[model samples]
Each structure stands twice: as C-alpha cells, then as structure tokens.
Target: MNLATSPATQTAPATLTDFFLKWEKSQPEKIYLRQPVGDAFIDYTWAEVGQQARRMATYLQSLGLPHGSNIGLVSKNCAHWLIADLAIFFSGHVSVPFYATLNAGQIQQVMEHSGCQALFVGKLDDNPNRWAGMKPGVPAGVNLIGFPDYAAINDADLVPWDHIMATCDPLQAVYQPQPDDLYTIIYTSGTTGNPKGVMIDYRAVAEAVSHTSVIMKHNTPNARFFSYLPLCHVAERNVVQATSLATGGTVYFAESLETFAKNLAVAKPTHFLAVPRIWTKFQLGILAKMPQKKLDLFLKIPILSGIVKKKIREGLGLNEAVLILTGAAPMPKSLILWFRRLGIIIQEAYGMTENLGAVSMMPTNDIRDGSVGKVYPGMAVKIDPQTGEILTKSGWLMRGYYKEPTLTASVLQDGWLATGDVGTLDKDGYLTITGRVKEMYKTAKGEYIAPSQIEFGFADNMFVEQICVAGQHLPQPLALIVLSDMGRQAERIAVERSLEDTINALNPKLHNYERVRKVVIVRDPWTVDNNLMTPTMKIKRNVIEARYDAQLQPWYENDEVIIWE
Candidate 1:
C-alpha cells in the first residue's frame, strides 16, 4: 500500500478513493482512534469508521445532494466528526468544519460563505433554543442532522442523523473524486483578525500528509501521540488528523484539562503536541511540587537522579518519544533548556494558515539554540538579505484564500509566499525569527531589539511562565513577566533575602544595549479574550502595551525588579 502518498500525482479520479480504500482493508482491525474518559477508553477501528462513513455517504446522496456539495460540520473532537468528514469525501461532497465554540453569528457567516447545503451538529453543552431559528437563513432545503437524538427526528423538516443512517444506502458512491477536487473548507481562527475560509483540494491535504510523514518517519512505530489541543487549529489538525493517514499510529484524545496528566499515563502516547502555555503550566506545576534546590540535593545522593528523571518522563508519557514538537508561538529558552536536562528534546516550528502549516524547524542534529528549524522537504525559504523579509515555496501551500483572490495575490508573489516574519537565515540554514516585521522597534540608544529575541533571554529562566520584552524609545529594555506561581514564590523569596544578588545571578549577560534595566512580575495571564494573546497564543504586542501602559513608566523608573501590586 502506498501509505505515504498516492502514486497518481496527475490529479485524477479513482486515485483518492483507492488510497483510502487501501488503508481500510490493510488496517481493518488496527485501532484508529481512542477517546479517553475518566477511566475507560473508547476504541474505534479503521474498519468501523470506514463502514459508517460509507453508510453516511450513501445517505447524503439519497437526500438528492449532488456531487461536490458543501457539508457543514460543527462539533468538538469526536469519532463521528471524522467519520462524517470521510463520508463527505467518499460521497463526493466537500467537508466544512466549524468550531463548536463559535457564536451563532460566526457560525452562520461560515455556513453562508462555504455555501454549505447541509449541516451535521453533535452534542452541545448548551443546545440553545434560539439556534433553531438560525437554520432557515441557511441555503434553501439545507438539512440539519443532530446526533444522539438521531433516533427520534424522522420528519422531513429536520432529519435525525441516525434516521438518515438507517434509510440511506451503504454502497460506495459512484462519483470518484479527482485529486484536484475540493475536499475541505477550514476557516482560520481569525487569530490575525477575521477568519478566512481556506479551500483545500484533495491533493493539498494529501500532500500535507505526505510532507509530514517524510519528516516524521525519522522516528518510529513506538511514536505514541496524545491528542487534546483543538483539532480546528491546523497545527493539531495537520500533526494529528492528517498524520493519521500516513502513520496510522494510535491516537488518544485527552479527557479534559483536569484529567490531562492522569490520562497521559493511561495512553502512554509516544508523541504529543501542545501550545506553549499548556507546556509552561505543566513545567511550573511540577516545580511547585518539586523545587530545583530540593531536587538537586536529592540527585546528588546515589541512584536517585536517574530514577527521578526516568520516572518523571514516563509519568508525562514522554518516555518513548525521543523527539517532541512545540509551536504556535515562541517558548521561553529557559524552559527549553530545563526540559533538555531532563532528557526530553523539545523543538519549535513555524508556519501560518497559508503555507499549509509549518515551514521550518530547528533540527535535532544541527540544533540552533534560539531558532525554530531548517526548512522541510519541498519547501524553499529565502531571506531578503537587506530587508530581512522571509519568503517560501512549498507543495503544501494553499491555492489561495477561498474566493479572495485579491488578498491571496498580496502574499503569493511569483510562487513564493511572503511570510510576514522578519528574520535572518544562519549559514547552517537555521532561521532565527526575530519578530514580525511590524513589531521590531528601535531604542533611544539607536539600537534595534526584537521583542521575541529578548523574550528568549528572560524565558531561559525556569521561574518565568512568559515574558514580553519591550522598550521602543526608552533608555533600556523592560520585561513584563508572568512568573510561574512556583517561580513567583521562589523569586519573591530570593528578592526579599537578597534582591541585588538574585538579579546579578540570573540576569542575561547583555551588551549594555540588550539588557533589561528592570522586570515586572505579573500574576495575571495574557489571554485571547482579554486581548493579550492572539488566538494562536502569540503575544499581541499592541494589546499588551495598551492594557499595561499605566504600569510601564513606574517599572522603567525602577532599577530593580518591580512587583505589580
């Protein structure tokens, strides 16, 4: 079986169907998904998922839906969600997934924009009574299929999903999808701003699966994966959902944030993907329980350090995965090195919704301390040496924003996607992303500092959760830190005991120009709804500055660490 990718690269029909069918047969009994609850695990095999998808596809066609009809799917991560998607593909219709958390208005906007003729909704925490009214505004005769309650609703007005399943034929649909046929419409999280529908052709999704497998094969069969992050984001989607096509590795969905650690032990996933914030919390939480001073003393005594690190890594379910990936934002260098000493290799990657996902990564073999990574296969990256703008070309690149050709042309110039990131590529091809071209600033000393670069400096310390480095026209740099409560208590104690010594011991060795004159330890989190973090978890510099403008001057006036009361 051509697991990595199909041999037919000519964008022909029957090729895609063959690829999926091949997996269904070869891996019929292989467990494809495992949803974790408090104690029990729900397993769904490839054969089961494929069978249900075929039945759903037949039912969709019975509704008189034509080839290439757009189907809306609004739900959280579930087996039915993916099964529904594959069914849409098998039936020759296109899949459109909307985040279940979106408001009714945002939901309608995507429903209209994608021209979704039919929709499938799963269980909701609060199934609003008003949501029924919003359905009429959708395309005419647009059907709504609700899960769990699928048995009761048989009326022509609103068909229950199970009813559709019972009545629709299970035979494979006649129309085979060409590789170039539309497969999905995933809207970006509007992180940078407004959500744009990204139309992904079959070939594009398949190629993304291929490119990822090309790199990941470097690891092996023991590569376990823990799935908790929202699949709506391409980061998790590409690495998890699309990765399944190639690796077919067992996937374990996290039960909830509360059960995250406990669930980690149960699945023992070989690989894991998480946002920087979550990883920080885990590290800090561990420290709160086990202080480094105590841990170090314990390690010095015979036979304990080896046992402790091994136990901790296994408890985190990272014992098998030699390589770990972190992205969606820059992580603190302090945190990165701390994990390194524990025997886990954590690497960062970079990409946006346009280039299909990640563009580069800091390699394991030729590691650059603060950089992301080297470019992946089929990806061409170049820096405008003088201007410092980054450019790229890749097979996984999006064709264009769905129906937004003008906006697409702005970024896709002469086949190279112009990334907004401003950075320099090192001689070894490791790219150091300083900051967004729009965010880098000049200081009063006539020297420039990238907030991201300075952030790496402060984060290198284990006590800091996140640090935003800034000083546009000021005399020196200022750091706003969200100390790990664990870090905060320790830092505060250190300050009370010996402020000058603490600062002298941990502060980054800077060339007068790059050193921060003072630090602000903030307990409050920078979040998306609060306007401090973008949806992708990147620091929103403008928002951070606006919200904390009042405190900046006071911190700058101080020569020592300033505690925000």
Candidate 2:
C-alpha cells in the first residue's frame, strides 16, 4: 500500500520512515544516535543507521512472512531498538514493543495476544536471573533474532545481528505504506488487568509527531533528546523516537540504570521528559547534597541564587535542557513550584495511549498552578457534565484496541475517546484533573473519595516518597506511604513527627469521610519487579488494596496516628 494511491496523502505530513529516508540521503554523515558503551560512546551516523536497518529489513523479508506481520521488539532503549523498528517499517510489518521490564508471564501474554511472527531481543536487564526468567516467554514457533550482547544472553540457536548484516544485502525494494496502514501496537501499562493493545496508524503517528513538534517549539534539526524511559510506552515512543525522526534531531540512549547519571551528563539533552518519581528523586538527590533549609537560604540571596540554580542544573545534567516535561501520572503542584524556584519549569502533559498521548501539554510559559495547560490546536476536549470525565477527539486517536472490537467501541464512541479521567476545564480552557473515573472509590460513609486529589495533599512532604489513599468500605480513607530516601535516613522520631504533622495539617482541609484515618508506612517499597508498581512508576491500586485490605481494619482501630508496617 503506497501513499500515492490514497487521497489523504496529498495533505498529510511525512511519516517517520519518510523523514529517516530523507535524512539518510540529505545528511548521511550526520550523527543520528549516540549509544553509550562502558565509559565511552558509540555514535551511529545517519548512513550507518540506514545501512544496518536496510540490511535487517532484507533479512526480515527473506523470512517470507506475510506482509504486515506483527514483529515483537523486546529491548531497553538502545540504538538497535530504533534500527529494528525502522527495519520492521521497511519490511511492511507492524511493530509490537514490550516493556523491557516485563516478566516471563507478561512477555508470553503480549506475545501470544499480538501473534508476533518474529521477536527481536536486544539489551535487557543486566541481572542474568531476570533475563533467564524472560527467555522462556517467547513461544516455540516465533523466530528469534538477537542484537549484539549488551546485558541479555544471546543463545547459540538465535540468529545474531552481526550474521544478518554480513550475509544479507541491503533491501533494494522498500515498502511504502499508506497513511492509514498500521504502524505499531502499544500495550498499555495495565494497572488493573490485562494490558490492551492500542493500534496506531502511520497517519496518527505523523499527526502526533508533527503537532507535538510545534507545541514543543522543536522544529529544528539541532534538537537533542535523551531516551531513558521505556520506549514501549506511547509517551516515550512519540516524544523521543517519532519526534526525533520528524524533526531530524539526535537521540542518546542511556547504557544502564547504574550509569544513567553519567550517560545523561554526557548527553545534556535539549529536551528531557521524566516521570514524577524521577523528578522527585532528582529533588531528593539535590537536597542530600545541600539541605533544603541551606539551599533556601542561598536562594534568598539574589547573587547566590543564580549560582546555586546553575550548579544544580549542571549537576543534574539538565543545564542545556530547553524543555523539561513530566507526565504518565499526576505530578504534585508543590513539586512543580519547587523546581520553579531553581529556574526549572516542569510542563505537566496529559494524555493516554488511546489518543497517541498528544491530547494536551502545559506550555513552557503561562503554566497554571493546578491545571495541565490547554488542549492542542487540532484536538477537541469536553468534560462529561455529569461525570466530569475528560473526553477528547483528535485526528491522531488510535484506530482501536487491537482485536478487541467491543472494548474499542466502548472507549471510542462517535470519534470521541473517553479518557476515563475526571477533570474540570477553567474559563480559559486550562484542565484540572480531579481523579480517574474508575480509580475513585466510595467510603462506608457513602461519599466517594478521589485518592489522587487526596494524594496530592501529601506531595509537599519530603518524608513521603510513594503514597496511595485507599479505603473502600471504610469509614474514612487511609494513606499508605513509602518513605523517601531522606525519610528513611532521618531519625524515626523526626520522621513520625513530620508525617503526623502533615496529616494533621491536611485532615482539617478535607471532608470527614475523605480524611485519612491512619498513616501506614509500608516497610517494603513497591517496584516494577514486585508487580506493585507499573513500569512507569504508577502504583497499582488494586494490587495494593489486595495486599493490605485484610489489615486495614486493625490499623484503623489502632490509636497511633502513624503505624509502621
């Protein structure tokens, strides 16, 4: 299916692959990707990337799979991941990306659901046990191709990337897909149940990337992006991969979790996007070096403030960042204001996989205290008057949930994607998200409580790292918290006093039903490995509730304001 046959192509923007081919010819020698090796960097120029991708495309074509076959890409962020994606596009296949952190069961579930014909395994967890657990997830019939060994073990039976490059010639006939052709299937980070596969077409990708470029003011080729987040996620895929391809920007990949700070320092990315947890970690790291009281005192001095902010930015490897964004979850307003004091403006974006994650973004300037900025130019947003649910319509919305017509119809009705999030729009069109439609739970008092709104109240407390306000069928909501690094290191008496103070100050503001009955400091942290949190750092409310529901009554009955788990 070629673009020439479609009328939509006449006015539609160039697709991601189109931009790649353009760059391959126009500036073949320009550095396109910088991948870190231990203590050094391996740069891949446009020509180098093109050559490898074309060779891989030829190999994939030789497999004789049906056109538009679903190909699985399992990898952490690396140069080869992008190359493999391009190869999939050139070979006329739909790419299905799995989160690198997925366990064996999750890998098998997505692999089986997507019906992937081939799986490209690349950089994964450095821990051998993790990779061992994931290896069996690939079904027997699926062809396996392994990238150069970085962290994952490349079994002897799998075809090596080097072998394909040496044996296969560059594919002479490249597949040119139409605007409506399926591009990729992104699985949601399912917090509740099985993740749904969102099918996005080439036109949606083009529209999302192009519109986001304009919104971010990153149209120039000099833009630099750091790719550390899970590329499988829609936000990272659009903001980092597709945006870079469309804008002719350079992309840098982090080597590993241990070396993330070092790798980021080298990249000094012009545009950086991180989850709220990451921003909190950065804040905590800074505070560890210079206590908040001391830093506040320095910032009060006009001359010292500038120096302090500059040093902090450079230390965090964001000195060159023109745009820093946070999303995938609600960020605390207090955290945004705290960064502002350091001259760092965090633009909180709002979107989901169903909308190609391009519904709205906070403008660099004109940031509202509690709102997630205005809607995009080509997007239509309306709140369900009764439910306060945010519904959006856009040209770039996903085609549907892959192979789930019933589910697709439920969310995508009459061209409007029900965001499943409740929010209010101000007179000026700024959006303030109240809570998720499904996440809100009713207390025994019959009043519904929005955990997210109540959770935000504790964001200003540095002692709290992760929090979930969950108490369904209880008289009042209870706060389950994980202590921050600072909190863990502080004297227990000090930590308890601080948390008690936070609850006391916050409870007066909330309704009687919404007030937190007790503050439970969970001993174990929720992590992706433990399945308590999603890959993006969002706590799984259902999972958390199931784990602690039996003990909630006892904790509530206890007289202590702060209970240690």
Candidate 3:
C-alpha cells in the first residue's frame, strides 16, 4: 500500500474498469444473470446490473466505512449477492464470502476473523437461522441489510441494506482499483481447528478467469454457465463468475440443491462446474432408478448399450453443456467413465486457493482419465522429485496469506508455490494427482496407503455415497463408507439383505491392501456445514478421522463385515 505516485502512472486511473465499462457500453440490455425462482427466472441485463452496482457502491460509501474494509456476505447462489460483490469493488472495499452452511458460531468466527466491517444478507438459505440469529443490535461500523426483512436501509428505522440501495444514487465513486489489491478472505471449511482465512488479490482472480475461459472455449457471448458451487470459494467466484464476466457469458444460479438438476435443464447451460461428491450422487440416482441387473445386461450388448446411454444423456440435461467440468475434489475415474459412457465428458481441473483457481486443467478436446489435463496458459508446473509434490508458478498465484508471513513464506518460495499435493506428470505432460502429502497414512505393518486412490476406486459403486480410508496403525487400511440414500433405505428391509450381498460381491475384486476390512455406514451426509467437507466439497480427512474414531472400535471388536446398524 505504498500510496506513492509514479511518473508514467501519474493518473490514479480506475483499475480493470476497462472490462466491465466496455461491457456496459456494448450490450447494456443483454441478460447477464438468469436466476431461477420456482419455475421461472429473473434476468438481469448488463446495464441493469451496472445501475444497481452503482447504487450499492454509493450506499456502501454513505455508511462512512473505511476504504479497503472487508464486507461479509452470507447467502446462496443468487444475482443479488453478485450485485453486492461488484458494488464493494466499485467502492474500493474487499468482500469476505461466508459459506451459508456454517453455524452461528462459525459465522461469527469467520466474520470477526476476516475483520468484516459490515454484513450483507441476501435471500435466506437453508442455514438462514444461523446467519440471522447472530448478536441482535448492529454495532458502530457493522450493519445488517437484508431486503424484505426490515425498513429502509439508509433511514433512521435502520432498514435492511437492500432497501437503502433502492433509494441511493446510481452514480457513486468508481474504485480505481489495482491488480495487487486484496479481494477476498475465505476461510477453509475443515472440520477441526479455527478456520484459516486465505487472502488473494484481484489480479490472481482475473487471471484464473482468463485462463479458465480459454480452456473451456468460452470466449464469446453464446457461452451459458450454471452457477452451482458456493461463491465463497475462489473456484466458483473465479471460474464461474470471473469467467462469465470475461467471456460475456450469461450465468444462471440455481434456486437450491433440490432444484439443481431441474434448473440446469431450464437454463441449458453450455458450461457447468460441480464437485466430485455431487457427480457421485448423480451416478447413484441414475443407477437406483434403473434395473441394475437388466442395465448391466444391456450394457454388455454392443448396440443396445449405445442406445441406452444416449437416452440417459438426454435425461441428465448434460446434452447441453458444451463444457462439463469437475473439480474442488478428486473425482473417481469410475465416475468420469460412467459419464463418458453416456456421452457426457466430465473434464477434471486441478488447483488450490493458493494458486487462485486451476493451475492445470484437462483441456476439453484432449481429456484423459487419471490426468488433470495440461498446465494452464500461464501456469508453470514442476514436480518435486524427492517428495512427489506438485509445485506451481504463475502470475495468478496468491499475493500471500493474510497477515501470516511465515505461512505465506512456507508455501511461496523462490517464486513457486509448493502445492503439497503429491502428483506426477505423465510423458505427455498431463498431470496425475496421486494424493495429498499430509493425507497419506501408514498401516500397522508400515505399509503406505493413499486413501484418495482407494476412494476413487469405489466412486461409481451404486451403494456407496462416501468412502474414507482409515485403520492407521492397524493391520491394514479400512474404508468407512457412507451409503447412498438407496442403500440406506434398503438397509432396514429385505433390500438390506440384497445390498449386503451386492457390497460383499464388489469387495473381493479390490487389491488385498485396498479391500475394505470394515465398511462403516454413516447416517449423516458429509457437508460443509458439518465440517466433514471443504467449502468446495472436498472430504476433509482430518475431520473424518476425528468424527468416526470411536465408532471404528466396534468393527474391530465384533469382526463384522459392515459395522453400522
């Protein structure tokens, strides 16, 4: 923050204002966001959105908050949230995105930790109570502004924030922001320990969008995008939001998790991004509705298999997505191939918050299994020979972790960020991620196990919802599985007997060390709110081990094939 004036850069001109300003001037009425309601959607044009953003920026400045202060936003995928984000930028402020899944305590922790000066509540989500039930009165610099819940935002009645936006001026201060300015502070959604805030800059975000849009072939206005992942993570913000803006693509935000598929069909998105867990769930839903035995028989038929798959593709709404991308977690190869069989190619991308979004992604045209495609346009990737760690260097790499110099130094060294993910580059330069160096565990007999590897093997299994490799310091690695809804429903009746038979049948084919000695079926689903998964939907090994540590004993004690009741 050296406010020093330079000779050539004497004018304190607007930062990256060129992108949006040009867009507003070009297609002012072109729809940018198509957010779905129950059966319909409300579309926001570029000019319309820009007008709202201007009002929001003026309203934000009217509060007399400090420049560059963090503003917390809690909501689901909605157009209003995105509107507020741009407004914050226009006013020269930072946005701290909070996962709507967190509990009250967690929300407070993240807000305070990120030093958020104000909070903007968009439409109520599943976890609305936690966000709304925070300490009652607004403080000196902190305020609550949720529309339809309170009076005018700028009035003495202390109206909600959105209400105030309606009356504010549509011409406020334009943020002449720079590339190096801090943009967001997102806390990791791991189960244990206080969440760690990862800080990144605007240039890193824009760079991620630029490269991703190119890789996805989304360079024009015709590219339609589906916004499903949490905007709190850089993955969604950079990939979906920034990419859409960079390419002039229209983004459609789903109403909720339950309406996701239906909304996808309605939007007919050309680009879609999803976490691996959701993809696995989609596989289960399709398999459960079909007669598995009969389907297997048809799959064996040379001609019938293609016919069956063609029908499945149309039903899944995947026939529209020109680029169906998967990341935020390691996707099982089985799941990808299952989609491929249906003529839906799910390409995988690899990266972390430290690298902005994706450092390397499987190109849409040259996709291959067990590989996260080629290094992105500007990213330089190198594998550590000694430890097999993946290292990346790029202009998009994060400026540094917020206020944690030592932590930042550890990851960023010699102009390269140590990814900590153990991976290798194939002869063709496609990256194959093996496992996390920290997540790899040793068995009682000193055998090493990569749990992600084992979990991917069972990803397409019809009965398994989630599988975590465990049994460290034991004779062998064991898998703790969370069964699918179909498998769980079947567990209490005659179906339980059939499912047990099916699960037992699949176990024998696994390698001796990889075979699940005890399958512990969990009642609860893994979620970001429960701390079992990351905000980006990655399974947190540490969280899984801690939550199920006690229950694992019964499996060892009873000598049971499946431990859960």
TM-score of each: 0.83, 0.97, 0.88
How much lDDT does each candidate structure score? 0.69, 0.88, 0.73
**Across residues 455-478, which tens digit of lDDT does each residue of candidate 2 receive?**
998998899999989889789999
Candidate 1 wrongly placed segments (more than 4 Å): 1-19, 62-66, 123-142, 147-160, 297-302, 441-449, 461-463, 469-478, 487-524, 528-531, 534-536, 546-565
Which residue pairs overlap in candidate 1's backbone?
A: 224-270, 224-271, 334-459, 334-460, 361-372, 361-373, 361-374, 362-372, 362-373
- From the highest TM-score down, the ranking of the candidates is 2, 3, 1
Best by lDDT: 2
What total of clashing residue pairs does each candidate reach?
A: 9, 0, 4
Measure candidate 3: CA RMSD: 5.5
Candidate 2's C-alpha runs over 4 A off are: 1-10, 151-153
Weakest ten-residue segment in model 2 by summed lDDT: 1-10
Alpha-carbon RMSD of each model: 5.4, 3.8, 5.5
Q: Model 1 lDDT vs. the true structure?
A: 0.69
Model 1, 437-457: lDDT tens digits are 767778889987777766665
